[model samples]
Target: MKASVTDKLKILADAAKYDVSCASSGSKRNNKNKGLGNATGMGICHSYTEDGRCVSLLKILLTNHCIYDCAYCVSRKSNDIKRVAFTVEEVVDLTINFYRRNYIEGLFLSSGIFKNADYTNERLIRIAKKLRNEHNFNGYIHLKIIPGASPEVMREAGVYADRLSVNLEIPSERSLQKIAPEKDHKSVYTPMNWLKEQIAENREDSRKFRKTPMFAPGGQSTQMVVGATPETDHHILNLSASLYKEQLLKRVYYSGYIPISEDERLPALKQAPLIRENRLYQADWLYRFYGFEVNEIIDETQPNLDLEIDPKLGYALRHLDQFPVDVNRAPYEMILRVPGIGVKTAQLIVKSRKYGRVRYEDIKKMGAAMNRAKYFIEISGRPLPAASAVPERIRHEIIYPAKKAQLTLF
Candidate 1:
């Protein structure tokens, strides 16, 4: 029996929830000359703005049928799930209709490998091509590149899509082999490398030729599943560091592993490691924006992130000797290492201190979370009291400050 479009949407959209790499940032496609839509602004998904307004996206899978039996995947061939695939026209129609109604700001399309990588990738490319050439969709489009797909197909995909991603589901090559024997790091990295080259060539061409077409203008990103195997946070962050340095990846998403099946090979988790997942994101932010190295966040001795507090605070607590950083005198790098000071705050401190000393009140106005920053930064060369520098005491105060009052009353 043929399913209605709504039914297919329900199935496919639900199937896509596990994929957390759908944040639409960095694309600047404007709707010029009366095109249907524009992506000149920040790409929207289920992400929020600083003002706390939520923007939505038409995030869904092209299909939920797979040929590989990856133990961690819900749509694995061995899993008994309802199977459905959207025709090219169906996806195009849905995207156009949804956009016209303002139901979504963009489209994020991924798929389970139906027959083979090439076949599935071709279908994805066709969807983007039809939307751009035939329908004149000037809106944002993020396509998930199929692993092991040909470079030719990938090149074509780049010509239409604003962003492309390939999920490296598992972190380590050995663990990936154990769960998904059909996939390897090469199959994932090869297409990523090809996309990197294509984006670079496109940029170079646009420099020389005024009207060169953009190839994945939003840049490429990838994801890795956390807690599925015995790999440590150190391993995951190291891989992310390498990707950022070598592949020049735009984002590396860490999705906490969700147990979809009762496979003996997979972990028997009662719930997803949401705290760890959030910590990984915080650590990733430190790496990207705060100028932190992977070793600074985690080491061989501390293999995992401290889930109670964020990575920056954890680092400050670990190395008490580094604080309290004098906001008016410290280098930008050292100011960034302070517990409560973010990149923006650190920048404000550096900019404002050029005139005179930056007081605590001034720092607070600059957006420093002073509750945490007060303990890690100095005011007019006055450091935090020596007693507050103890790592264990600081940890206790930061994690359970309310308890301190209760203990004092007792």
Candidate 2:
């Protein structure tokens, strides 16, 4: 007997859990002329489920019948899982009905290759197109770009998709070859480069003419799976930095490798590397927003992150010479380098400085993480934490405050 739509949804939804690149920020599609929904500039008001999947969007896979037998994938051709696919109209109905019930604010659709790249990509596009033209659904729609799909098809995709992504599952090409032999990095980069140019061109056209259609205003993003290969955090972060600078990507998602099979080629992990995944994100944030270089967070000397503490704290410990920054007198750039001061806290400190010299008590009021920052920041009249203190002692006090060795660093 053929599977019902509910059965297909259960299987495909489970398969889509591996993808963590579905965020609704940076899109501004409004519900004009009796449209069903809207995607705002402030982003969709969404929250995560207990397992970390973005529940605000109806995240699902159109199908899990893949042509490639990648070693790490759950839906690979060699897997003996029950497979099913949703028809284009069935997907449209689901989106429309689900929206009516307020179960989702938008749609995040991905699919495994069926027959070939173009065939699968076209089906994905058709779902988006129908949602826009037939049902007048104007909510956010994020579509995954099938690697090696023609530019012509991708152009149409940009028209309907608020954001597009291509998952670069492995950080290095050599690792990609060993794990997913049938795939190549070129297939992924080609589509990403093309989207970059087209989004740029579309912006220029829109500037010249107001009636020009939108082409992925939210921009492109990609994912790189961690712990699946031997590539260190250095290699992973360097690849991410290059993507942000060169490709002009909106985001680089880091998904921990979830061991799906006992294949000899893959690691036998009892759980996903969630901690390492979080550390990479923290490191990524430091590079993007905190004015730190990739090498500063992790370098040739220490390739992997210190899983015990965050990247910012690790940096402060490594370079003790820069610590105990004077909050009242230090430059805003230097203030950001302090481990306990966040971007917002740094800004607050700077803004308060214009009125008067920022004090230790005022910083506490701003919610600065003084436990860690106390050792790293110096306020006027308030004596500096003992700069002569050993780095190991500071690290121990920060990591384990209960053991509170009478620290030389206040």
TM-score of each: 0.95, 0.95
Indicate which candidate wins on lDDT: 2
Q: What is the lDDT of residue 37 in candidate 1?
A: 89
Model 2 residue runs over 4 Å out of place are 381-383, 386-388, 405-410
Candidate 2 accuracy as TM-score: 0.95
Error of 1 at 270 (Å): 0.6
